[model samples]
Target: MRALTPALAVFALAAVASCSGAPDEDIPRRICGTKISPEITRPLIGRTGAFNEYSRLDNKSAQTAPCDLLLDEKPVMSFRFAWSSDQVDPMKYADAESTDSVSNLIEPRRTRDRYKSVVGDDGAMATVACEKAGESHFTLTMKLPDATKPDTQLRGDIEKFMTAYMNATVKEFGCRSR
Candidate 1:
């Protein structure tokens, strides 16, 4: 029994030693590094849903990964980084909406926030041009909530919020404005 006791002790020690440096369980949920903060989203969208990562398919059959902030299970806001190789011109987006009803009404104009409300759509949109890490024309869009009856003052307020939100994103991501 004494001889067996030494073997058992060795076995116990070996078992513990083998498992001591075992890898930890993999955690699946990771926050998308888009710098969408609660301070910017809560006032506009009430409470934000979980951080989501998704890919958008561009016209050239390429994918652009974006960090999304969802509200009521819909992605009302998103941020993405891209290179100039994609040949995406953020300013040209306004031209595409020229046929919309609101396009004739308000005309998609560039202000501090670059907001363009769709004539017949439910919400407003803003796009900011960013230069990320020396790559020019990197852009991000802040999709504001839909206003049932958006007046001039309400649109002004939305633009202010969108500008502040874009500024916060710029500061957080260390990107220069283009």
Candidate 2:
């Protein structure tokens, strides 16, 4: 009983420090030397839902940017930052959306189906997925264009533009039940 008290106190202290209600910059980063820039990440970075108004802590799980636009003062559809982990290979991801599930994304793009993805300009790999909830979400992944190589090993394509090409492929995620 006596040893348990000390352990409990230490745990309590850790929770308090982490939950201090400070801004993201003030809080320690998540992992993988990952940093957050508030200028790029506003209230909700990758949220796509009907927004009559905006508020802080509205969509913490998703990534988003603020907008003062001609269309509306709403969150711009975008993606959370890429995740880098030693345990897991550094892989890009779209922030989980309120309307989307894994099943939807991996399915075919049929009228009966409820998912779609779009890869835009090469600078960054971007995907916009929509679901039956009438909510459309977006996910942008960092581009590592210099990683893929042509099939020909001896061919000059790999030698010429290997380092300059982006390895992070923004290929259309086709429907495949794996």
Candidate 3:
């Protein structure tokens, strides 16, 4: 069996450490900010309607949100890498692109041609996937709760979180598809 490397281990540690909260409060943050679709859930639930973090790995009853402000909750990171050449599911790609019911909790506004991002009353992020295929690779990024604006630094955290999940997906290719 191949052995572990020190550099690989340190990188893992750093990724987990930054997963929660902004590195610094002053820096702009892009959390699964209260993207709660207003249509579903009780209205006037308060701007601080309180958010919950459920594990993509497992479901649990619930608990106090790790962050008091909804903007502080880190979205569960996930990705789909199109790598296999022979036979892959077109429906799978289609589902994410044309028919993903990530959450039917909100009405969609015309955001762009590629996809419509339906923001819930709480501001949780989901996507109507658009595939820009590369020769042998395409990446699907679920950047839930992305910061609303284009603060360049905020995008860094987005890339960091996405890269970590994508790399994990590439490594754990045998796990069940979501």
Supply the TM-score for candidate 1: 0.47
Better of 2 and 3 by TM-score: 3
Across residues 1-178, which tens digit of lDDT does each residue of candidate 2 receive? 9999999999999898555433445322211112334323222222223333222222223323321111034423212332121111111221223143321211112111121222212112233331212223433333212213222321222212211112121122121211
Reference-based TM-score, model 3: 0.27
Q: Order of all candidates by lDDT, from best down to worst? A: 1, 3, 2
Candidate 1 stretches with Cα past 4 Å from truth are: 1-40, 46-63, 78-82, 85-91, 95-107, 113-134, 176-178
**In order, how many clashes per candidate?**
1, 15, 13
The per-residue C-alpha lDDT of model 3 at residue 86 equals: 33
Candidate 1, run of 10 with poorest lDDT? 22-31
Per-prediction TM-score to the true structure, in the order listed:
0.47, 0.18, 0.27
Best prediction by TM-score: 1
Question: How big is the positional error of residue 73 in model 3, measured in Å on the Cα after superposition?
Answer: 8.4
Q: Which of the two, 1 or 2, has more TM-score?
A: 1
RMSD of each: 15.7, 18.5, 16.9
Q: In model 2, which regions exceed 4 Å deviation?
A: 1-59, 65-126, 130-135, 151-178
**110, model 2: CA deviation in Å?**
16
lDDT of 2: 0.27
